[model samples]
Target: MKKTRIAALAAVLAFAGATLPASAQTALSENQILQSLQSAARVAPPNLSAALIANAVQEHIKNNPGMPITWTPLQLLDGLAQINVQIQFALNSDIIRPESYATIGSIADALHHPILAGYKFVVTGNTDTTGDRMKNLELSQRRANAVMNALVTVFNVDPARLEAVGLGQENLQDVQNPTDPINRRVQLINVGKYLPGK
Candidate 1:
């Protein structure tokens, strides 16, 4: 695929530089590859996309205290497993809800520890099944803020260490069912982590 795009771009450049040698196209491809590599390096080390981080947040936190890294998105239920990083809430409610607190709390707890200290995070709010797009967006923002505030005020999480944002209803349907109960969630994303893989 990369070769294809490079070839296509080279062809265009070749067309414009008709008087130049065909070899010039090779330089263009080289340049294209160089740029691509540079960009990839920027997000290398399994850079977690917002989607993955969001999914992880919604999952229930069931990690052991000994582990350096815990992913709640991988909880098991009656032989079935639930992904951490996503937590559900009632319509229009910014409440941390129940059991769900375990997930977010563990994350805040992890960040509070000395090993993972110095990292930052984001609390993104989402909603499903009950409001107009604009209204949902506003509510989502409120919820995100509420969740962030809870982490800071109640859990002793640092205020400067986190951000709260509302994705509204977008990115929810990107997974399976758009209107499913699982779609309503809050995704916690860690800073300097979950970047794209090389």
Candidate 2:
């Protein structure tokens, strides 16, 4: 039942166009992020391991070439509750651009919300196919780390609640046009509960 709702939401997000250009992007409010994440979590599958999710992402990238990959690869994450936000970075670098700070702040705010306190999230970075796959993977990791760091250091989010991964160009939002800007995004996925015993 949960899986069904997740799939339906994912389809809507896929078709409704999740990504927006930086110039036209509006910062998602803290309440908006919180609500979307909470709704997603309510219908999310239980006990999704971070390591398993990471392995799936890695396997997807390994099996598919960056330039001609399909949205099919994203099925690994299809039933998860996730949101993609456009996070701008300096050219070929992981430095979060100033314009995106507000968006980052909203993410942090959402993470700090009381209703989401029991959840852990994965910060997955993706890149458009504009450069070497290896290089893009590295940059994406750094960018993901940067966002995680900001959430922890600046917004007081618990470090234990976040994991960062970079998928590079392996999962293109715009598979028909690999180099499309929409392919580059940061995804925040609610992986599971914060298991203190783990």
Candidate 3:
């Protein structure tokens, strides 16, 4: 039994040592290395954006040459930190319109991809400075939450992996025009680790 246990430990050690890259070991201490190796053993699921999925499909087709690709669960969830989708709600209200479906659907589709199954994201709502500061903040929060709810209830995305926050007029893309429609936007940020297990 002792010999069998020793063999098992040896095999585990071998696997751990084999999987870790040399460059990764350069900065980590012995304890950190052990922790990292243990974490690495766990397979992380992919969480992706719709734009990224689309780009990945395009690349896949390019590489394969002469094959059609389906958009269902596109199996993509890597590359890029953010994808900007234009999602607009009704003016002065948090009601999402039918015209917004194309962009929102894309976002939902990305979150539904299997490659990005375990990923978490932040959906930030921003508003123009045309309204009172406090009201704008509250409005933005509502808009953000509305989008989050849509992703959860309508798209079947994992609610636990999504968070909504309101930036209000704080980070306006159009600095010159406080009332610019461009200032009113929702930004999706992938809060997941880029390389995972860092």
Best by lDDT: 2
**How many residue pairs of model 1 clash at the backbone?**
21
lDDT of 3 by residue, 5-105 (tens): 22322222212112232222123332332233223323324554333433543554455443122212113322223333346577788899876754565
Q: Per-residue CA lDDT of candidate 1, range 1-198, in tens?
A: 434433443332221112233233333453542232222213322433334544443332222223233222221111111111455466467766775555455545555655445544566666653557557767877888887887788779877666776656553522334455444556554444312232
List candidate 1 stretches off by more than 4 Å: 1-84, 88-90, 173-176, 193-198
Task: For candidate 2, write residues 1-198 as lDDT tens digits.
Answer: 323323332322221134444334444444455556656524545666546666776777677755454555466566466777777789888898986766676677667667889988888888888988888888888899998988788778899899888877776666666788877888888877788767
Model 2 residue 66 distance off true place after TM-score fit, in angstroms: 7.7
RMSD of each: 20.8, 7.2, 20.5
At residue 144, candidate 1 shows an lDDT of 82
Per-candidate clashes come to 21, 0, 4
Worst 10 residues of 3 by lDDT: 10-19
**Candidate achieving higher TM-score, 2 or 3:** 2
Highest TM-score: give the candidate number.
Answer: 2
- Candidate 3 deviates by what RMSD? 20.5
Scored against the true structure, residue 192 in model 2 reaches a CA lDDT of 70
- Say which prediction, candidate 1 or candidate 3, comes out ahead on TM-score: 3
lDDT at residue 22 of model 2 (Cα atoms): 31
